[model samples]
Structures are given as structure tokens and as C-alpha cells.
Target: MASRRTALRPPLVSEPDLPDIVSPAAPRRSSDLRAAIIEVDGEADLAHSTLEQCVLSGSGSALDLDGATMMDVDVRDLRVAKVSARRSTLRRVRISGGRLGTLDLSDSGVHELELRDVRIDYLTLAGCKAVDVRVDSCRIAALDMPGATLSRVAFAATSSDEVDPRGMRAEHLDLRGLDALGFLDVTALRGATLTLRQVELLAPVFATAAGILISD
Candidate 1:
């Protein structure tokens, strides 16, 4: 007698592409800083430095924090050429109305960062950890955050040409009213939320990722 062959079975439940995100951070206030005209020179700890309508000029990381922290600061109209802050922390800081060349925050930790109405040429937060980061009404040329970890991040009414969030881990990502025209790695947005219009715009990308064939 001939034996019968058994057929293979498919998976009962498919695993989710995104990770399980936990609760986001609560809102917190920073200590009020006095208004002054402060300059960022060599390694320093800028605490309570409110330089509104001031120009912070530097050349290739002329100002280095070196594991320092900048807390409760408000910088408006920033004119920094290049700032390399890899081992610094920014807490409850607000920056607005400026044309920054490069603001490198790689391998750093930021909390309650708000960049509003600013135009950044190149911004990098790669391999960094941020909480409660909000970029509102800003125009960023390039925003690179590969391998970064974020929580409670929101980009409201922002425009960007290049946004690279590959290999990033984020929770509670709010991208409402974002007008992005450059390359958007949709596969990296597994745990992000989007509006209905955004879903419609990225339908083809999603279909391609799902291995679905669409015919006319």
C-alpha cells in the first residue's frame, strides 16, 4: 500500500510589523530663565540662557557642550554656522526663526525640545534618544534620525524635503499636517499614525510592500 503525504500549513496569526509602544511622557515645565545676550563659546553649560532675537555664530562646533546640559533656554533667530553637540542634553528649549547650517545631536539625549518657525539646512539626531520633541511650523531641508529612539514626538504643520527615519524606534508619533515631498521610507513608519489623506497618498507604497498586484 502507498503512504499518503501530509501538506504544510500556513501560520494561523501573523505578527505585527510594529513594536508594542508604551505610554508617552507627561508634560513638564522648565524653570524660567532670565533674558540676556549670551554667546556660545568653548565647552559650557548653558542653563537658563534666554537669548531672544540674538545671533549665535560659530564655525565647526565652536561651542562644545562636552556632556553639559542646556535647560530652560529660548533662542530666536539663531545664526549658527555649525554646532556639534553629541554629548549634550537640551531640556525645555525652544528655538525659532533661524537658518541653521548644521545642528548635530547624534548620540545625545533631548527632552521637551521645541523647534518652531525655523529653517534648518541639515539636522541630524541619529542614534539619539528624545522625549517630547515637537517641530512645528518649520522648514527642514534634511532631517536625519536613523537608529534614533523617540517618545511623544510630534511634527505639526511642518515641511521637509528629506526626512530619513530608518531604523528608528518611536512611540506616539504624531505627523499630522506634515507636507513632505522627498523620499519617505514608509517601511520605517510601522508604528506611526497618519491621517486618511496620508493613507490615500501612500496606498501604492503600502500595496507594494504587501506584495499585492494592481492591474488596470
Candidate 2:
């Protein structure tokens, strides 16, 4: 019998029923946004802000949410060039149907987060501590996770052009559904699970790393 931990548990995200409408105002420090659409026209400094049960969607050149805390938030249909939430904390957040040039969440603590139907040029979670996260049906040009710690993370029906997981620590990380073109550090996937087709696809890369030559 397979252990419970062997299976990837989906993120427990509560859908937000937002009814309030918020004006396009620059968020102040420690702002509390609830049940509203937080739109960012240009750039908003959302550091130390708390957003609960709200929808955040907009088009902007840059949006920064460093050190912000979000719970039960829905981030939908955002067309941003650069979206950064470094060192932020997120729980029960769902980010879907977004097009972003760069999405950086370095050094953040993320729990029960789901990212689906998003297209990103660069998606990085470097040095992050994430649990119960899922990226489903997304297209990413580059996915970087150096020095990050991931638990019960899975990528379902996702595709990435490049993946760099150097020095990453993962437990119950399932990458069988990820169709990645390249991986920077294959050894960093020690504790992750991959399907036989993925293993066969990476066999040459593994052999190259081991300096093994097969000529038949």
C-alpha cells in the first residue's frame, strides 16, 4: 500500500466571493483590503499589506507586494510585465489566467497556493518555503527554484522551456506532469517523482552528467 505522503495533495483554496469595489488608489503601508478588486494601473507598493478574500487583477508595468500577507485571495486575469512578491506570505491563494513577464516570489512562505492557466516568461521561487502548492495547465518560459524548499508540490499538465532547481530541497514533489525542455541541475531532483517517459527523456542528460558514453 502506498503511503499517504506519496500522493500529492491538492491545495486547499477557498474561493473568494468579492462584492466590494475599490477605487484605483495607491495602497498605503499596512493596508487591509477585503472583498474588493485591487487594481494596479502602474506600480503599487503593497509591502506589509494584508488582503483577505479579495480579487487582485490589473495590467501594469510593475507590481510589488514584498512582505505582504494574503489569505484566501484570488489573483485573476492580470497582465503585468513584472510582478514581484519577494519575502511575502500567502495562504489559500489562487492565481489564475494571468500573463506576466516575470513573477518572482523569492524568500517567501507560501501555503495552499494554486497557480493555473497562467503564462509567464520567468517564474522564480528562489529561497522560498512552499507547501501544498500546485501549478496546473500553465506555460512558463523559465522556472527557477534555486535553494528553495518545497513540500507536497506538484505540476500538473504544465510546460516549461527551462527549469533550474539548483540546490533545491523537495519532498513529495511530483514532476511527472511537467513537460520541461531542459533542466539545469538534474541531481537536484533527487526526492522528486518522475514518470518513465520523463526518465527516458532525461536519460541522455543523466548520462552526460555521469560522463558515460554509449555508442552502439
Candidate 3:
């Protein structure tokens, strides 16, 4: 008798309830916002803030969200040049239909986060601890995860130019839906679950890492 394989667990995420009436205002630095819709026209400093049941929509040149705690927040149609979200705590957050440049979530704690239909120039999760994160229908130029710890992170219908996962630790990380051009450190993908085609494509990279040269 053969042993049965375990089923992969997808990210268990829940959508936030849409508010019927929301207060419209501009974002402030280090302020507590609840049940508000923020429209950013220019640069806004939202660092050290607490946002719950809020919607952030609009275009801006820069948005700073470092050291913030966000729960049940939705970011929709937000186009920003630079987004700094380092050292933050995010729970039940969803970002959709946005274009972001330089999204840095270093040293942060993320849970139940989902990003859909978004385009990002640079996304880094350095030194961060993340769980149940899913990226779907997104385009990312560069994804760097050095020194990061991720659990149950899955990517679906997502494409990336490069991915560097050096010194990263992951469990139940599904890479089947990710179309990545190359990986910087193949050895860092020990705990990930990849498809058969991905393994065939990465054979040469693994061979080079193991000092096994192939000649035709």
C-alpha cells in the first residue's frame, strides 16, 4: 500500500466588509484612521498610524506606511511611485488594481494579505515574517526576500522578472503559479513546492550550484 499525499492548503483569507458610508479625507502622518476613505493627491506620510476598516484609493507620488498597524484595510486603484511599509503589522489586508514602485515590507509581520491585479516595480520582504500571503494576477519586476520567513505563501497567475530568496525560509510555499524568469539562489528553495515543469527548467541552475557541469 502506498502512502497518501497531503493536500496543499491555500491561503485562508477573508474579505473585509464594505462600509456603506465612509468619511473622505486626506491622509495624515502618524494618525489613527477608522472607517475612512483616504484620497491621496500628493505625498502623504502615514507612518506609525493605525488604520482599521479603511479604504485608500487615488494616485500619489509617494506614500509612507512604515511602522503602521493595519487591519481590514483595502487599497484599491492606488498608483504610487514609492510605498514604504517597513516594520508594519498587516492583517486581513487586500490590495487590488494598483501600481506601486519600491514596496518595501522589511522587518514586518504580515498575515492574511492578498494582492491582485497589481503591478509592482520592486517588492522586497527582507527580514520579515509573513503567513498566508497570496499574490494573484500581478506583475512584479523584482522580488527579493533575503532573510525572510514565510509560511503558506502562494502565487497564482503572477509573473516576475527576477526572484532572489537568499537566506529565506519558507514552508508550504507554492510556486506552481509563478512565472519567474530566474532565481538568484536556487538552494534557498528547499521547502517550496514546485511543479514538474519548473523542476525541469531549473535543472541546469541546480547543476551549476552543485558544481556539476554538463557539456553537449
Q: Estimate the lDDT of model 1.
A: 0.63
Show where candidate 3 strays beyond 4 Å: 1-7
Better of 1 and 2 by TM-score: 2
lDDT score at residue 121, model 2, on the 0-100 scale = 98
The true-versus-predicted C-alpha distance at residue 59 of model 2, in Å, is 0.6
Comparing 1 and 2 on lDDT, the stronger one? 2
lDDT of 1 by residue, 33-106 (tens): 23333544333333222222222322233444445456555555766666566767766667778667787889
Which pairs clash (backbone N, Cα, C closer than 3 Å) in model 1? none
Give candidate 1 misplaced runs (Cα > 4 Å): 1-36, 40-63
Kindly state the number of residue pairs that clash in model 2: 0
Q: Write the per-residue lDDT of candidate 2 for residues 169-212, one digit (tens) a residue.
A: 98878898899999998978877888999999999989888899
Model 3 Cα shift for residue 23 (angstroms):
0.8
lDDT for model 2, on a 0 to 1 scale? 0.86
**Better model by lDDT: candidate 1 vs candidate 3:** 3
Clashing pairs in 3: none
- Candidate ordering by lDDT (highest first): 3, 2, 1
Q: lDDT values of the candidates?
A: 0.63, 0.86, 0.91
**Model 3 per-residue lDDT tens digits across residues 65-94:** 999999999999889999999999999999
